[model samples]
Target chain A: MEGFIIALFVCMVLALISKYLSIPAIPFYILAGVILGKAGLGVVHSDEISRFFSEMGLLFLLFFMGLELKLERIIANPSKVLKGGFIGLTIDMGIGFIAAYLLGFSLMESFIVGAAFYITSTAIVITSLIENRKLMFKETETIIWVTIFEDIVLIVILALLSASDQNLLFFFAKIALALVFMYGISYYGKEFLVSILDRDDELPILFTFAAVLTTASFALFLGIPETLMVIALGAALATTDPDAFEQHARPFKDVFLVLFFVFFGITIDFSGGINWFIIAVICSLAIVSKLISGMIIGLTIHGSALSGLEIWSNTISRGEFSIALAVLYGSPVIATTIAALVIVTSIVGSFTAKYSTWLRRGIVSRSRKKALMHRPH
Target chain B: MTLRSLNLPGVGTKYEFETDKGDTVAIFFTKTGIIQMYTLQKGCKTPSAAEMSPVEARRLGNILTGAIIEADQESVEIAFSALADLRITIHTFFVTPAVVGKTIEELQIRAKTGTTVIAVCRHDRNIINPPPTFAFEKGDAALVIGESDQIKTFEREIMVN
Candidate 1:
């Protein structure tokens, strides 16, 4: 109990520091977790309660992500979401897989690692956009489409990765079933559920929680990971009147998310057993590789080099998704490595976002001056 | 009727009107800022979209071409007026205490020396053309527009020694 209190306090301090400094909180939280964890100070240990909260955090993260994704918006630009997203994911994941494989990871490990890096943190991107006042910029529309696309792609990848060694047709059929069930619930089941909430004003929060848990459990029952299902369900819910449902659900989502980050910090092992040098190298490579891949794909699709660079820089931020994947399937060595990489990437990405605009503006101004100097008098 | 049109510098179109059958001729400005004059004509038809709203078609016809032309004009003007440029920089030492709750006009007067408060940066956000009643806060960076000599005087007076 005393240890838990200390852990919670540490997390709060780290969160505050990160917020004030305009830095990613993930690294500090992970550092705090490492210090309190069994591998470092041995103040905090992996327990059932912590594990449970961590899982809940993952559930809520997905739910919130799902809520943000409005299906109607995707429907309006299906090709931009699906085709562009798929291509971007394929290229990014392929590059990452090759890099991991060459670094001595097995095919399966490489595949998982590659998949981890393919997904971008929409939360980070959105926050950066708002901070920079670029949310309404011309490039923002493209970024939103691509980011949403990447999220859906992550869901599909998670689904495929978690599947057993079944035939392709069987795997596809299962996915189809999941989709039908998701659509059925979203379309028909939501109205009945919403009406019940309407009758009872206090029931909305309870209903949202119940719906998330039940859908996640159902997905687990069907041999699918709850993470994908939770996201899908949240997405389904998002299709409803966002203002009506979101206001109630947002607080719950935030609380669970904070707990998730705290739990993530507490579980990470920062023992000397892992090679810090290797981790640093891998983290740098991961950020650079992902940034390059995103830039290439964004430029190809959007036809703007600057827009591509901005998207690339923003998308390079790795957070909960990578850690979640690492914890679920990776060995402690792999998990620690991935966690360290995510922390580094997030910090670098945030700083990149903070300064990228200034740098771009400087370049533009210099070029304009050059043009003026060369003008025929 | 004698109708005359002139290409006004730094402005768009200007039309002048005169009439042979003028009787107590009076000119009135329309709500849309266009000047109207009563005159007799052989025939009149409302202008087509091509003539009335050429900007829309020009924008659609080629955005890059339009942007290039606009940019060229701006560059030419800036180059020609380069000597008239006045740059000013003001530093506030006790921004939070001195500036907060002070009106823009008050700050302008306090800063004095002819410096114009053009913009303020706070919390990593830039506020341009800040209102008169806008209060300054801690860590706020202000962009003052004035001559170098005036800016130096303004900073010395308003900023903490």
Candidate 2:
């Protein structure tokens, strides 16, 4: 069908744009989605295909997250990552929860919004940090550690999202059972498989993907949450041969992620149902709350206000997870608004982070000037 | 052997490490230790890459070499903060008669300056974690990890008449 070809063309154009611009490619992908999907020309119309791929994208995203997750490192103590993540999560979710309620969303939708805003895009921040040679600095390190914690927190939210719609006990119990089984298989299976194959690279990936797919299919047949099953599979696989998956499966994740974003874009009706003002307000509030969240986390880590600001600046963008949440719980109004917010924050977040030093200095000088003007002789 | 090196002439060398899945990971490294990475997969001919620059090429190189593993944010902070006691610094001495002839043991850098010479990079040599018996040569640049005050102490010994 033309669906696959149309998807490829959109992704290609987005890729070209990303090549010239020094930003995360997600927002651009979204833009491509906007142009090609229902919001625009309506070129690709197969909802079933797009939906399936989007679901796959979500699995792949979490899978990649699992691969990069240095579980042992994080578990190794009551360290900065834990501390900052704890503080950031508190502020982000707490503020987001209040804000969502004030805006009149249901309890479920409020949780979704809070969870969505609670995360800063690790992909965007890490990219900029390395590009600008900011990693050597203490603040950048704080961001990295904080991101690890954020990932774990988001995983919890993802679990909640999957369990949100269901009769809690049923969904959660099955998910738990599935997770236990998956973990045992992944943890034990890794060593057994490695004996049969050494550093071959291809096998671990193929095996893991195959296993996850099988689990997903089985879950679907059994009426369990397939998304949660895949996520559990990914996290468990992380305990096994992470290097191989990171090397091989990551590329597939990226490809599918592009598909997911395009699908997300297509589903959004950028027309007229959503209130633009509410979107604008929430978007603005998201910016402030994220800054506050990052700052608290950063401050807790390094005990510096500037460090907190740097953290905020570093991770202001919302990407895959946020969009996934929006698609799930967000109404047409909310989804469209979120798309706009993601686009704005992604660009703004990068700029703020890149020129944080200058921005800080400018603020300091202006405040000094204000103090001088107010002083009595 | 799909891991071919491309000379980006103006930028520096780019190493494209193609995984067995036919996914290409290109790490573009510059002389000054800047590293940018890109990945291509899915038979998408257009190389729509993310400029993955979250760590130094030097640090990443060390990671690849197993010199560092999982030195995450907290651990790195602790290590750097500990540098108040002693830090890492590199200095190159352009072949002086006084400093060139002494062996590392004779130079006694650790004893005198509390500075351990982690590596000695000659123009044509890679002497990482050099032995104490490693003799000092003209134009030897040493990467030392020590306290600031101690680095000053060691610099004097290396810059002789």
Candidate 3:
């Protein structure tokens, strides 16, 4: 208990410092875990209890995301949502899976690797957009919708993939059932829950937390990934009222999230045979794969070469989501590789964002001048 | 022709005129501070009468006519007139250096004025009908509602220039 408390304190301190310093907090949290973990000072041990609770951090995080989602907005822009989601996921996952396969990973390992790579960190993307004051721009809105769609697709894919080995038809049937259940919960169950919540003037935070946990556990029982189930619950709530859920769950989310990072940091074995070559290969793959995928999606959608490049550059930054996926799957190599890639890509992405406007302006000006030159005057 | 010769919506006068393509105009009342404006262009569809209230159409029409007359060098055709009324209420007050940390209610009482605090603007977020217990922070834009004379005095007394 003492060690856990100490580790938590250290992780919080690191996270606070990193937040102010404009550094991504995930790496610091992971570092904190390593320092206190068995691999370092051994102040904290990697135990199943800690792991189980810490995993809830991801669930709450997704739930929080769902609260913000509005299905109407997606329905309004179906073409962009569907095309961008399908293309972006396919390119990122396909290339990543191929790379992992080439690196001698088993099919399952490659599949997990692909899944990890395919998901762009929503926190990182949204934060960057807000910071840049580009959140209101048309292109940014498009990107946001695409990212949201990708997240939804990921939740479904993760759930299905994590289900026990079954025939294709069985898997399809399970997916259909999950969708129907989600719809029912969203339409009917949500209103019932909200009314109950409204009547209870002194509703304890534990009740809400327990409800989410129980739902996730129930999902696991039904052969669904807990992460997917949690996210689905969140998405359903999002269809109703986000503000209430945000108000209720925010405090608990913050507490467990800190533990989640500490646990993640503790799992990193820095000194246990560092493979520099493998790290380098993974880092390179991360950059190339995302860049190619983003560029392809941008070009395909906008039909503008310049916009495609800009899109490619912007999508490169990876952070918490990538790390969380790695940790969830218990792949240390994947985690470390993703961590290194995030650092590299954030630097590159920041630089790209800084100059993308200028590049876009130049391209537009050149095109205009060329058009004028071609004029009959 | 005199200005009164033109049949304006408010003035109850009807005048026939032609407007050039891609011409924009704005009409507004100098007294009430209401303004309405739109563009007259080829291949542009006008909003339906049902979409706009009678008063709004009149205001919008006047503004459009005024804009067209102002840009008389361009040809324009004016038929039935309508206006787009943009009502802007000046919900303004000042943040005094002295009353920095006090709650809004306490400040309202201490200030000894009937200036109703309508809203508080903190950074990008706007809090409307903020609670009495809501403490005032430095650099907050407090939107007050009251009689014009009282508001002016309140602004002068409380708001820092």
Candidate 4:
């Protein structure tokens, strides 16, 4: 209890600092975990209560992801989403995977590293776009689509990683059956579900809580992974009343997700000698890979490299989902590497997102000056 | 003017159109009911944007449509007194897809809500006491007189599907 209280207090302080600076609180929370946990001062340990809260945090985060997934919207604009999504996947994930493989990590660790590298921080990206008032720009739309695409791909990655050792066919069939059954219930009970969601009392929240808990517990009972089931449940519920579900579940997600990040930070072991060279290389590549993909997407979709620069500037951060991947599936070295990546990229992303317009303007004027100098007067 | 709408995925729908001044105006209607309007002029490097609450947007809409004209409180009260005595008021509803292409007879507005269509205001002209067979067109504003509850009924039944 004392340790938990201390951890939360330190996190609260860090959260305040991050908020005051108008930057992301994610990397700060993880840093607090590192400082307080065994890696630094050794003040906090992973107790049962903290562990449970952390798990809730991860589950709610995934559930929130499911709620936000609007498949129809993605389908309606498949061209842009696919074009931007594939460009990002090939370049970002490809570079991340290859880089990690050459750095002496195992195959699975490399895949984890690659995925963490590939998935940019959606919260950081979206929040900064709104803050920077860049939403009106053409490239903003492409950036959003790519994030949505990464989210969909992350779900697949999580499922594959979780069920890697299971009998592949049976695992897939079971998940498929569960998803179909959930979808059928949501479809047939759409009216009933909406009616319940529209209620102004406690039932709506209770129902949401009960639905998530029941799904989690049931998945555990059936020996299926709870993460995928909760996400499936969320997606099914989304077909009914996603906004309402989000409203009711947001409080739980907010509190629990903080614990999830901090606990993840706490568990990251740096006892093995730190690989500074590899970490530096991976961090640099994380930024460069986004630049390459952002340029490609911008040129193909928006017809301008400056717009690509804007996209890369806003998307340089690897945040919550990356850390979630590390905590869920990474080895100690992988976790440490990802923590460093998130901390560095997110801080850098905040500044770049803020000043990207100035950067673009600088480049434009510089090019124009060169053009003028080369011309005969 | 034709409005081009683009889906902004997680944000909202963006409706853009070029004005007579050759400036492109994009209005974003977010799912959370916030409205953002951006105007980009030719040769301008950055667009000018403004954010508004849904209520503010509606008030601006009323002004744009000339529904709420600039009148002092006393003058507005005097104008309302003419209809206040009989508990009757006027409501102006723009023609929506649900009511467009339907004749006054088909809508049975009088029978359904005990309201009378006093006038139909189109872009160029206003028609007083339109005939029963008069078919409504898009962008036409029907000015009807009725009690408050009857006006609500008309809005519920006819103005929207």
Model 2 stretches astray by more than 4 angstroms: A164-171, A195-205, A361-377, B1-161
Could you give the CAPRI-style class of model 3? Answer: incorrect
Ranking by lDDT: 4, 2, 1, 3
Q: Which regions in candidate 4 have their CA more than 4 angstroms from the true location?
A: B29-35, B53-161
What interface RMSD does each of the candidate structures achieve?
Answer: 20.4, 14.1, 18.1, 1.5
> How closely does chain A match the true chain A in each prediction, as TM-score?
0.88, 0.89, 0.83, 0.97
What ranking of all candidate models by DockQ puts the best one first? 4, 3, 2, 1
Error in Å for residue A320 of model 2: 0.8
Q: Best lDDT goes to which candidate?
A: 4
lDDT tens digits, residues B13-80, model 1?
33445446542222222112333333223242111111213444344334433322333121001122
Estimate, for each residue in A1-377, the C-alpha lDDT of model 2 and write its tens digit.
Answer: 58667877868877887756777788888877777778888887646777777777777777677666666667665476678778878887888778877888788777877787777777777667666645434575567777778788877776666665688888767777877888887777767855533556467567656765787798888677666666666668767665555556667777888888887887779665777676777778878987787777666667777777777788888887788778767877668877877888888887887788777778778989999999999
Which should have the higher DockQ, number 3 or number 4? 4
DockQ of 2: 0.03
Decide which is better by lDDT, 2 or 4. Answer: 4
Location of the lowest summed lDDT over 10 successive residues in candidate 2 chain B: B70-79
What shift in Å separates residue B111 of candidate 4 from its native position after superposition?
Answer: 29
The C-alpha TM-scores of every prediction are 0.65, 0.67, 0.66, 0.81
Candidate 4 C-alpha error for residue B98, in Å: 47
Q: Chain B TM-score of all predictions, in order?
A: 0.40, 0.45, 0.43, 0.49
Instruction: Write down the TM-score for model 3.
Output: 0.66
For all candidates in order, the CA lDDT equals: 0.65, 0.70, 0.64, 0.87
Q: What tens-digit string does per-residue lDDT give for candidate 1 at A1-377?
A: 67767877887887888778877777777777777776677877767777776777778877777776776767877776775576667677777788778877898988778877666666676666555444324455566677778777777667777775657677667656886787787688767766755755667878777877888788777766788777777776766654445656667766666666666666666553777766776777777776676677667776766766767666778777777778778777778777777777888888878787766677678989999999999
Sort by TM-score, best first: what order? 4, 2, 3, 1
